[model samples]
Target: MKWYGASQRRGTLSRLAPDGKDVKAVTLYTHTFFLIEDGRSDEQKQPHYTAVGATPEEAEAMAFAVYQRAMDCNHAMQQKGPMLIECSHCGIQRRVLLPPAPPVAVTRKAERRFFNLF
Candidate 1:
């Protein structure tokens, strides 16, 4: 038995028999994901935004929309924190964090070369 995703958004769970035949199969319908989290303040009861979508791209789009809204509503001073994505089927979760900033380049003073031709 193996669980795999179909061409469409939904997934399919199929079982193979000894003769290489599909004995049983089940199609699991995909559900809309409602990912929400409070920014900066964990004590807040309400989340900063509620991102909803059935696919990952959709969810990201929704998140981006909310992000824009936050920027406009809060003068572009929105809090940044780790976001969570949970799987509705197996209850698996993953956290997305911001990457570290690039290192700064340090410039050194060039040593003066002596040109004495006495």
Candidate 2:
């Protein structure tokens, strides 16, 4: 499937300081696994997976494990799209060309056609 609004993967700019300063870290109450959704809206990406942790490190480790497990099974994955990764309290965008899922399987039923001639 094609992802829409690819440019809005990052967080909003208003959250930054007025003096054009970037904050290094933000307070995290609980570690969460959020999927960098495919959209260009002015909204933060929500967590799609059910993985959660008490700390950022723990959550990240779990996310990595999930990634590895997925890659292990998706042997037919194609290296085409850029995978967006979001860490705890950080809005830095990384451009890593990770392999996407395999193409969907399309099966059609075969129908026999009969023709009558005089």
Residues 1-118 of candidate 2: C-alpha lDDT, one tens digit per residue: 1222222111212222234464543333222233344543333444223334545565556645554443234223222335654332322222344578899999999866667432
- Misplaced by over 4 Å in model 2 are 1-50, 75-118
Checking candidate 2 for backbone clashes, the offending pairs are none
RMSD of 1: 14.5
What TM-score does candidate 2 reach? 0.25
User: Which window of 10 residues has the lowest lDDT sum in candidate 2?
Assistant: 5-14
- After superposition on all C-alphas, the RMSD of every candidate to the true structure, in Å, is 14.5, 16.9
Overall local distance difference test of candidate 2: 0.38
